[model samples]
Target: MSDETPIDFSSVLASAVHDMKNSLCMLIQSIDQLSQSSSHQSKEQAEELARLHYEASRLNTNLMQLLSLYRAEKHQLPMTIEEHYIDDLIEEMIAKNEIYIEKRGLTIEIDNDEALAWYLDMDLVGNMLNDILINAMRYSKDTIVISTEIINDELHIHIQDNGDGYPQEMIDLIDLPMQDLNFDTGRTGLGLFFARMIAKAHKNQNKEGRIMLENGGKLGGSVFTLILP
Candidate 1:
């Protein structure tokens, strides 16, 4: 009689996600090289290649988030808090998706102070910001604004777009607990859940970080804010 515990499928899924993430990284690189090397192709071909690159990049980002969330649930995620300039972080994120932004004829406006710094897990926060920015670019009409401020002794980072705002249901759903999120619908739920978890991981003086989603900002569209104490 052989007695063995049942294998946890979740762990297997996590491992698969990690492998997929690595593969996607290579695939994105290849797509980038192809786009660059085949610049002399027809306009239609170029556009198609650009679309392929963007979708691959987005998928890679999603897989990374999924793997990180899995690690977080297992209490294996390590967060390193360090002092970093907000502007520097934003610049890196913009540069990362610069090609896609340019192809889409979109613009990003920065209103952050060059000297404003924060203590946070840069990798985690950067990933969250990049994902939010990528999603914003898809919905923004033309201009996307990235701003930073200090409000009520908490550091606030805002990403606003000049386009139709988020659907009312999504804004309402964010207020509920992550466990209550309906994953059967859209990617918004997963992205928001990951962002919320990352934000709440930071704490200081009994204050934890949080995120907010509101419509009707300076851009008259959707505004996403990350507040960290």
Candidate 2:
């Protein structure tokens, strides 16, 4: 028998995800070019392009979350703490969703200081914000808001939506310890789980980042909050 152990399927899965993400990047780029040209003649064609753009965006987000989860499993994801201004961070998130926001007549409000700086992994935090914003957009009626503040020595980032709010069962998970997420509920659980993992990775003075979910905000819907120390 060969001395080498059988190949792990997990590695294969990771490779596949990487390939998919690359393909998605190309597709997203093409869509971006199309949006810039802004020369669609027929209403149906415009709507179709919008639909494709939204799905591709969601797919891209899902792949990113998967990569984050894989990194967590291998204990290879590193958090690089640096001082980054809050204004730039939230604006980037808004830009990521701009295509959908414009096509759907959605409203976005951002509340953050231009000069406020925080130390955290900017990429991971951005991914968390994008994931939460996508989730919010799915359930929101029209308005979504991104807010940031420093609360009790932790950076508080909130993405709120004005929809019916999260179902009771999903809300219950925040109170309990992290467990095997149920895909049966139509929630991939990757976004929330990845957010929690990224938050936990940033530690300062014995405290770490955390994720919280609640209903009733300025928009009277759902609020996804990340606290990073």
Candidate 3:
């Protein structure tokens, strides 16, 4: 008589995602090395390498998000809210994507006060913003702007692009309550859902963090806003 416990499929999936993330990190490093060493290669080859790097990096980011979501589900994700300078955080985000931005001929503009600081889980917020920035880089034709301002005693961080605005359906999906989001249909819903969860985790006196998706910004394109209290 075997009395073994049944496996939890979600936990197994999380384990798989962790393993996949490690493998992806190695692959990304290898691709980066190849890119740096192949400077003398042909233009087509260079472009191909750049494309490979970008896709791999994007995949790595998705894997990371998946792992974070799994941890959050299990209540294992750690939130360390601290005061961090807005400009410094934005600089790190830009630097992380500098290579891809250059390859795509994109410009990054920062409209944050250097001394402005915010209290939140930097790792969670940073990862969410990184994912958003990656999407912006993919869609923006030339310019992407990162801005922060305090609105009604809440911190407002906005990432706006000069690309075609998000589809009406996507905007609608984002506006839906997190419980109603369909995570299985596509990555868009899942990413936005994760972003919402991360945003909602930060709290203050009667106020909580949130995210908003809008179009027709200063750039006439899509805007992603994260508000924290």
Candidate 4:
């Protein structure tokens, strides 16, 4: 028998997903432009536009998670760690989602020291934060609070939404590896899984980061915290 290994289907699948995501992004842009130019007073038209946007966003999120997981499995993911200002990161993230926030009448508050800097992989960390932000926007009533601080030698970032906190069962399952779940229940589980993976990947001087879920923050809602060392 030949010594060569079998073809890797995972890489092929990931590339396909990346291609599809790019196409979907183009489609979303076209739809957005059309929606902007064509004024429709009917509720059906508005609902359809909303549905298209939602699906596009969901697909993009899924594609991102798949790519991240694939890289993680191969240990090929780049951890480009750098020292960045926490406030600037929060500002940029909020600006990127301004349209969505305004459309949903949601308000976001950033509470972080402007001078605080930390070492991290900005792209991976940004993806993780974006996922958390999207989740907060979906479940929040009208407000979300993002905060950061340094405790001991670790940095802590918190994203909290003013919605009903996650049930105890859901919070308890976050640390475990990915598992099958019912889509009908409106749970992707990938978001948290991706967040956990990103957090664990961030390490400094032999210390690693961690993610935690809690309730009863300043927002009186669910809090997703990332602790980095």
Candidate 5:
């Protein structure tokens, strides 16, 4: 046998990611429990715990997105497109974010037809929205809105916030290639890049999903739209 390293680095990375996710899941749960526990007293302490919660959430999301991108690169990320009520879908996103919304004294708005059902990969799309909400929660002033509609035979989903709006760099990202992300600007391009990948994964007929970032929204801040076909 030829002398060679037996370790498959790709498999090793995937397994390491899986194990990291398990540990992060437990850490997230523990933080949630701690937040709910009344023994937490001071306002500053609570705030710190809440930040921890959000960071934990961010890390967990990062890992999940990594695994998804990996699978997608390997053509293994299955798209589970099915008809789901738009309200229920956004509601689950709101529920996951209930803690931060309450803690920050923020308001959330939902605008969608009550009886509309749309076909898409709910898990992938939902996680995409979750990442959006997490970013919005951190940046918004006091309000966020989630709206959905069928525009021109495609499902249009928008997540808007009431704040200063996305940075000029981020708004400029719409025109840049995926490989043009600047890492030295104290920003990691992973989340937005992941969002873009997710949008592209959803395809129907001859159309495909698209993502855009805009400065002005109904909330007068920034808007992130994922148009799915």
Candidate 6:
């Protein structure tokens, strides 16, 4: 018999999930077009369609996180750090999310120094921000605020919302590594876990990036902070 074993099941599963994500993207586009063309007279139909689109978008986000984590664990993920203007990144994200925010009648305010530049993996950072933005969208009451600045030689980015904030249990769990699959808060905890992993991946010289949770911010909501050095 050959030395090589059968095909790896994990690899197969990852590939399948990747394919499904792409298909779901197409599905979302189709649904979005249909929803845009439909008349607003059918309230129930429009609400159902909106829900379907949101769920599909959420599934796509989860699949992406899974794939990225898989590649990261295998040391196959690329980390390409480059100097980028912080304001441009925030602007791009806001533009992409405008519709989602408007649909919920929420307002987002971004505060940052116009000249601040940072060296980091743009793609990974973008994904990390995307996850945070999605979480804020889901939990925020009416407003979201993102801010960035340099403090004590470290770059800090904060995403905060105007909601009741996270439960005490979740704040406590931020420091601990993810070791359980059974979540009691009805939250999957995947986004925070994924954010932690990405933050830890950003290292410079001897310093590594970190993520933290706090109860109070400008918005009086849960704050997700990422620090990179």
Clash statistics: count for each candidate: 0, 0, 0, 0, 0, 0
Candidate 1 ranges beyond 4 A from true positions: 1-15
Cα misplacement distance, residue 123 of candidate 4 (Å): 1.4
Query: Which has the better lDDT: candidate 4, or candidate 5?
Result: 5
In model 5, which runs have C-alpha deviations exceeding 4 angstroms?
1-10, 182-188
- lDDT string, candidate 6, 195-226, tens digits: 77788888888998998899888889989899
Ranking by lDDT: 1, 3, 5, 2, 4, 6
How much is 142 displaced in model 5, in angstroms?
Answer: 0.6
Candidate RMSDs in order:
2.2, 2.1, 2.2, 3.3, 2.3, 2.8
Worst 10 residues of 5 by lDDT: 181-190
lDDT per residue for candidate 3 within 1-229, as digits (tens), equals 3688888766787788878878887877887788678768776776676677678777877877887887788888778999998887898888777767866778898898889999988878888898899889888989999999999999999999999989998889876877788877788887898888898899999888999999978998899999999
lDDT of 2 by residue, 135-186 (tens): 7887899999988889898989888999998888788776656576665655
lDDT of 5: 0.82
For each candidate, the alpha-carbon lDDT, in order, equals: 0.87, 0.82, 0.85, 0.80, 0.82, 0.79
Candidate 5 residues 1-229, lDDT tens each? 4687687655776899889988887987787787788674587777777787788778877877877877777777888888998888888988776766766778998888889888878899888889988988888998899888888999898999988898887878767787786646643377787788889888889888989899888889989999998
Task: Indicate which candidate wins on lDDT.
Answer: 1
Clashing pairs in 1: none
What residue pairs clash in candidate 6, if any at all? none
* Root mean square deviation (Cα) for candidate 6: 2.8
For model 4, name the residue pairs that clash.
none
